[model samples]
Target: MVATTGRGRQGRGRQKIEMKPIQKETARQVCFSKRCAGVFKKASELSVLCGAEIAVLAFSPSSKPFSYGHPSVESILERFFGSSADAAPATPPRHPPAAVLIQALGRQEKELQERLEAGKRRKAALEESLRGPQWGPVGDLLGAWRS
Candidate 1:
């Protein structure tokens, strides 16, 4: 079996091991403990190096909770989960002027009505055309108007 080490500088001192089923379980527990400690250590190092607050939480294989924070966990928790007083309440979006909206609606309605009437006329013309010589006289009249 191949062994794989953890990533990052925090994992520098740790070594990977290969083992069987029972040994794998033991190795897993040991790795988890070491990695968890490394994670907390890195968090602490980051907070100190950057002068930034940090919080971390993890649960072990046994379901026991572990946590770490710089400058108090509650402060970080409050900053994370608490709402700021400076935040503005969300407001409904404003619309265009009522006059402009009404005008646009009226223009759209007129265009749609014109299109409907033109479609009806086109359908009637097609039906007449399909009826053969019944539309001959109308066609002749329109041909004369075109001339």
Candidate 2:
């Protein structure tokens, strides 16, 4: 068998290509799809391991939109608004009309209240579980077993 020569300029053979921006249309499209999938996968792993809420919005080269959210994009966005509103100053920003500002603040407030109630309920359940008689006193366990 004859030995093959070195890589040609067209790169017909697989040569180490640069990681720079892809110039060719077809190659760029393929790269975009692959990279987007990788980004979403990494984001999923990050949220699962860290218990983090994440939301991602991406626009493809063709102006197509895509999204990835752990839990949900809406929930994460609502939490963000609730946290931001909590830290906001008394004076509302001048850009948006007062009516819009008031409406947004009201929504954020409602969401914050719901979140707080949920937390309180969870705490109550946990506390009640701790007080349960599942594994009462060791002496009681021994006495009951003996009887």
Give the alpha-carbon lDDT of every model: 0.78, 0.80
- Expressed as tens digits, the lDDT of each residue in 88-121 for candidate 1 is 3232223578999999999999999999999999
lDDT, candidate 2, 1-147, per-residue tens: 333556533323555667788778888889889989999999999988886778888998888998898778776666677757666433333268889989999999999999999999999999998887666698688879999
User: How much is the lDDT of residue 61 in candidate 1?
Assistant: 71
lDDT of 1: 0.78
Clashes of each: 0, 0
Which has the greatest lDDT?
Answer: 2
The residue-level lDDT of candidate 2 at 21 comes to 80
Model 1 clash number:
0
